[model samples]
Target: MTRTRTALLCAAALLATTLQTTTATTAAARHEQRCADTSDTRRGEARRVMDIVREAHRDLGLKAALVRVTTDGREVVTGAVGESMAGVPAGTDMHFRIGSVGIAYMGTVLLQLVDEQRVGLDDPVSRWLPDLPHGDEITLRMLGSSTSGLHDYVTDPDFLAQLDAAPFRQWTPRELVAFPLRHPLWYQPGTNWSYSHANFVLLGLALEKITGTPLERLLDERVMDPLDLRETRNSFTPQIPQPVLHAYDDERGTYEESTFWNPSWTTAPGAVLTGDICDLARSARAIGAGELLSRRSYRVQLDPGTVGLPGPTDTCPADVCLPQTEEFHFGVGVIVVNGWVVQNPSFSGFAAVQAYLPSERLAIAVSTTVDQDGASGNTAQRIAERIADALAPEQPLGG
Candidate 1:
């Protein structure tokens, strides 16, 4: 082989390598473009949603943002932006604490029992949880509807002080409920509407007593599996699954990772959960559609007799016992803002929302972790509100 012939072979090999590199780069760009909108069916609106998410990420000073919007069970746009940790890109599949979404799920389970004739909506809590104070007066409907009139234990000053003192302490349902029970009822049971963690916590206990099953296992077999929410699993402790979306907050005077903070006090033991954005969207649709409930049970879940309640009295402050009107009222475990069924939960440093517009069957779910001085407490819900405005202007979501 002469020098000229050898040089010609080397040049040909170099050209082939360059072409391969170019092709790879082009394919990568196309992949990114494809993810801009989840499906080709609604390219126009999905792109607008992607723009909203990017803008929110920048403006809100978010460390990570995950969103999924769907119409009629189909994806409009699903995306994740920012980092779970420095140098680690966020993804829609990473799990974060779902916060109050579990309350909605528990409500669904109670309705299921009603459908099965195992329990009646009006049955006194005394029937299942006779040990509870005022159990006879507080019925199942009241418990699920947040009209039980028990003050929210979360609002109690002592509970807040203890929580701040030991952020990682594991709390039992009874111990948490004690905070509210120690104080007198804000008003007679079932007289008006007021948010109360004790209602749900006691409801969880009643459910376990009635069903003779652990809430964790029951949720998996009934709600999570049936709805195809594979990633929505109850945590016994602070553990999150692999690919965790690390969270940070400045609540203790400095920004610190709080991903592993014990959330046992957030709700019932088996109901504390973590999930990715996709499951969050699916949950919104399930609750919005009443997919698992019978016609009668579903109707009650939406209204639950809270509407037309007389406005708050002297004992119950107007703010605490807010009026229950058709437009913006408490519907069982969820909130009805306009026509959107919603739950927005902020726990530790994690914030998330699951909002569904029943009229259009549109579901928007967002989960976020904020920077030290970034967005407000419920930044995920704020992002969802903007998406709802852009996609379904006629039926806006607010709380």
Candidate 2:
């Protein structure tokens, strides 16, 4: 989940309380999580990982690089490199906005509800949002699979212009959905593949209405609670918790700290989330493994019929309507590359990636912020792919 035009999920086993805890309380929670994995003595691997991180941090001019690598739920390495502010060092446990991790969580929630028979993936969302234009033609499956054909509001020129003009604006869900509706459907619903934040935003709304639960509580109960992500949490404001790993960007033609920039337009409101690297890796494991869904639902989560959607059409640009293939494609909210499931979110100077190789039970999570005048991009993703290549060369990860 990223802002392709600009920039671009969960609680513990909450899918969490509002993460307004004092610094000490958050530390205690982190300690408890660390105590659960005490047998991780992979020094050799850890050293290798540290070297990789150091090289990336330096090469990419990252202000801070927070990372966690785990094998079968055991820590292989966890670290933070560089500074959080002028002279303050960043810590591994510092919390950062998880970006599109919420997308995966939202998708997971959809499947969890599906597994419980609360709703069918094929059920039309018109069942809930009766007034949604073309709701009858758009199925929950299409929404979660990003085949809904709705234009990604994040890519709309007007949306980006507004965002650029007012980075601190508190955007409403209806406002975000309005951007896509302003344009005709990208293609017939469910007949093509395109990454649209509108799909997830709409899904979040429909889900809330379907269960009479807010997206925050719904995700915590169904997804985060089961995963036990103590550090993961939802925030109503742009306020990231203490020991925050601050982010910087030059997108506005000025290098500045974007740590508190309102990210409401990124996705649905209640679903915006933040967490530490450890929780990020844990999230990769849970969502990638489909740990909370039934076997049938898990299988569907991995491949929800997007394996070979028709290629980009005239109405759909090739870059926007990405090609879906076996090695690389969209699966629900996650992106599948080789055999790794990934969610990479980059926006407002913060970039992160959580990737899991289900077959190997290996997970890699990385988050980074740019230094003043640093090269700008999703550097975190490039780092994770490199790590995946090093750890599982036989089954390389990436597009």
Q: Tens-digit lDDT track for model 2 on 46-126?
A: 888889989998988889898899988888888888999989998887889997899898988888888778999999999
Q: List lDDT for all candidates, in order.
A: 0.87, 0.86
Clashes of each: 0, 19
Worst lDDT 10-window in candidate 2: 7-16
* lDDT of residue 335 for candidate 2: 90
Candidate 2, overall lDDT? 0.86
lDDT of 1 by residue, 1-399 (tens): 699998999999999999888886774464344334444658788789889989999999999999988898888888889999999999876889997898888899999999999999889999888788888899999999988888898888899888878889999987998898898998888888889888888888888999999999878888999987877899988999866999998877788899999999988778898987888988999998899899888888889999887667999887788888888888778888898999888989999999999889999999999976887679998899999889888877765
Tell me which residue pairs clash in candidate 1: none
In model 1, what lDDT does residue 310 have?
Answer: 68
